[model samples]
Target chain A: MAIRYPNGRSYVGREPNKKPNRQKELTYSNRGMTLEEDLNETNLYYLEKAIAVIHKKPTPVQIVQVDYPKRSAAVIKEAYFKQASTTDYNGVYRGRYIDFEAKETKNKTSFPLSNFHAHQIEHMRQVLKQDGIAFVILRFSLTDEIYLLDALHLLYFYNQKDETRKSIRKSDIEKIGHSIKIGYHPRIDYLHIVDAVYFSDKL
Target chain B: MAIRYPNGRSYVGREPNKKPNRQKELTYSNRGMTLEEDLNETNLYYLEKAIAVIHKKPTPVQIVQVDYPKRSAAVIKEAYFKQASTTDYNGVYRGRYIDFEAKETKNKTSFPLSNFHAHQIEHMRQVLKQDGIAFVILRFSLTDEIYLLDALHLLYFYNQKDETRKSIRKSDIEKIGHSIKIGYHPRIDYLHIVDAVYFSDKL
Candidate 1:
């Protein structure tokens, strides 16, 4: 299946011809779920159980020019981003702040350091200093495999990008990161990992 | 002087013409601080002293289409509102959850009930029921007067909207609502009201 990116470029995922039929669009539907939609569903399930209150931060946009035609609402005619965001989701979960960034890579071998921004690394450092739980949900789109890498692990590899010069190997990630099994109920049962990592020790 | 809305429609603020000139298209000096900017400044000051950790909830928008002009970034081309938000700000303060909505009204005699949506009212109702602090920060633009109206008082008048058939009177707000002194440091000085209303009884 082919997944088209924002740049009109497409990449083949796990099954070459397994693009699920959603209407007439021949887009790759990886079992009818994107990383965001899955996490959103998972968040809802967690919310219902009163496990955590997590919310996806709306993508921040710096609107440059706007045109309001009929006086209802302003329409952004032109805009530019000020900077890349630190994380994708943040919320109060069981009186503790939870912050994380979710990314999916088509590369089956390893996640690339280029997938993250320098500002995100800095932000994660600050979150850590404030005793907030921070992690990255990395999905190998080709294998449909997902892993939760703590900010410390991410920071270690991100810093190594300047020294070792290459990205972290798949073997290293597999060893260090917590593998999250995707399911039909919540899709990505990440809270189980959060429970095992964050809550259990505190309790 | 008329303050032009993005639509070129003019709206009456207290003193749009009072702004001292900076003489630039991109660098027009604002006469007074916006509610959001003031709240952010206030939050920063509070955070520095470990007084409270309050954050303005990011404005919610439904992004429809995006343009990836650069590989490193994505720009929102079109977007809309998903729904009305419940509150303006929420965070933890002294282990208690704080939630509130800030509004400014040009009308001096009374604050129009139209500012509070039905869904927001219901959301506040639930929050108050859950033993959470929910309130509204009202800024009377003409007098530069700000008041912290507790959710109970708001709900009382809101329920009587049909029976009384009138907007909330300024006199009533001044009577029941905790008057918050606007200051340059904290801007709204809302925590003082919070202290007086919620924590004072305990002390």
Candidate 2:
């Protein structure tokens, strides 16, 4: 018998003598999920477990024309994407304001500073000055390694970019940042790193 | 001769003999600005002064089709608005997470409970559980009175709508909520109220 998955893909029942390849399935599980998808799943897990209240802001768009057809919902005819002025995700966790941006880089040797905009850097500075937790989640796609780098270190490298290397070397990230191991339930478990880095004493 | 404003409106020079009506201008200044506009201006003021980092999230939209022209930017051809799963505005303030939804009503006797959706109420509940500062900004257009009602009070009235009244009476709001005076600089100086309500010890 054949069964259809929720995604509408048909799957044939496993053959009586065939063994499931668990290792291959585990490896392929992380293949299609992007960093955004991982973070979204992780954030949803956080929210459902009553652990945190982080959310990604919607993509900004400039709407130019809309048509309100009779007895139908309004449809946008023309719109353009607008640049975001702040980081992607933010929320409250453990009585603290949490703010961070997530980016995936295919480059293995280093994470380029150009991945960040000057205004985003400036926004992080303001968040830090206001005593909120600020950081970035950097993921290297080739190795599937993820690191949480503090905004302070990111700002340092960004400000002195013209004088120094354009990107933060991978070695520096491994030394200064905390690695996040992807898991099944949450995908990217970052709040554990937050608890260690920001609320260690309380813990 | 006519001088054009940055908004593209052309204005003729004032008559030499005519006297400027400062009172009328002051009264009309608040006429054109909506509640969202006032909040946006106020949030910008807070951001520029390094006081807080608050922003109104962009409207959520579901893009269905996009067309990328040969030598131009991508244009969204078809899209529809999506219901927001959270409050419209959220950010950090003085090391605490701040979240709120703003609404303006022309009704004078009461603010309707229908102004809030179930998911928004649920979102506020989650934020409160996480120890974040959550509230709603209510603007009564008839009297031009603005009040910051705590989420606890809002949730109480919202949850008890069937047994009690369908709306929160203006009298109840005036007694429980904090009034924010309209100002010239920030337009709506809400942080002072925040200081009094949430950070009284530090203040």
Candidate 3:
């Protein structure tokens, strides 16, 4: 099957020529789920375990028209998805304000800057300015690898976009980002990495 | 005009028995707008001024049906509002995680406990436990009075429901809550009250 993004990109679950690793795949359940779903499940697990209070903000929608045939339920006859003014997930985590955006790319070599919007970058900068923990969760679906990249590095690369390549190379991400180890109960344990990066004892 | 709450209460703009006081009425411009709208406007003002990064989370909706006749447009045929798992507004302000819900009541004497839900109270408790600043912005629509009551005080009052009344009285709110002065640009300056209550230098 294929997973579709909000921007209308359809992602096939399998690579074009690579054979499925049956033995390794059996270890992880819900490998078919998208990165967003995996993160939501992780957040729910954290919530239930009283570890964090993160939540994904609902997709912003602009209602153009509505039909009220009866008094009880009004139907939205016309609506469009609006460009979000801020990132998706935000909450309080261990006495710190945590804000982040999750994006998945099938490209094995690089994560495109085009995946982010100007407003979202600005919002992340504002969160960082307020001393909140801000970062982006990058998932390379082809390799089934996830990394937590701090917003400061993202802003640095974004500012150099005009003069450099339009994307961050995999090598750069591997050097600067913290790899999130995938787990069974909480699939993407990004918060563990967050603690190491933002709340480490050295700080 | 009638302002309908999510809980199905209707709030009329005018009180029938009271004669309109022209001079006092001219003080407030958007006297007819709902409390939610007023708060939203205030948040925008704060954002533009770069004073705070607060926003009302979008209303969650379960989309049951949709029709996509064209490639560029999608029309929602049926949808229902979902009970939010967290508070309405949340963001980082001055390096602190801020979370709160805004509610209004037409009742002149007290704010009803029924205006809130068990899940919302639970969410607030979790935010507070995590050391995030949590509160409820109460608007007495009939009297045009606004107060910022901390979640600690609210939880105390909520637990004493069996011994006390089912609502928090005006006198009690005035005693425990900080009154928010209305302004032309920001309208309800609730953050000013938040600073006084939670971040006072003397404390």
Clash count list over all predictions: 2, 0, 0
How close is chain B to the truth by TM-score, in each candidate?
Answer: 0.81, 0.86, 0.84
RMSD of candidates 1 onward, in order: 10.3, 7.1, 10.0
lDDT of 1 by residue, B1-203 (tens): 88889988888765664434533222212436666777789987886666765666555666667788756677677766456445767655655667788888889889988888887787577566646678998878767778899999899988888756567899999999988876768776788889889989787
lDDT (CA) for every model shown? 0.75, 0.92, 0.86
User: Please, what is the TM-score per model?
Assistant: 0.68, 0.88, 0.85
Off by over 4 Å in 2: A1-30, B1-30
Give the TM-score comparing model 3 with the true structure, all chains together: 0.85
Per-residue lDDT of candidate 2, residues B1-203 (tens digit): 68889989787666542443554364534366788999999999999999999999999999999999999999999999999999999999999999999998989989999899999999999999999999999999767889999999999999898856789999999999999998878989899999999999876
lDDT of 3 by residue, B10-63 (tens): 976567535445635665533567888888999888888878888899878778
DockQ score, prediction 3? 0.49
Where model 1 places Cα greater than 4 Å from the true spot, the runs are: A1-29, A48-51, A71-74, A82-86, A156-161, A165-176, A201-203, B1-30, B44-58, B63-86, B90-99, B119-135, B149-179, B189-203
Model 1 chain B is weakest, by summed lDDT over 10 consecutive residues, at: B22-31
Candidate 1: CAPRI quality band: incorrect
For residue A20, model 1's alpha carbon misses the true position, in angstroms, by 7.7
Q: Is candidate 2 or candidate 3 better by DockQ?
A: 2
Lowest lDDT block of 10, candidate 2 chain B? B15-24
By DockQ, the candidates rank as 2, 3, 1
What is the fnat score of candidate 3?
0.61
How many steric overlaps does candidate 1 have? 2
Number of the top-ranking candidate, with lDDT as the measure: 2
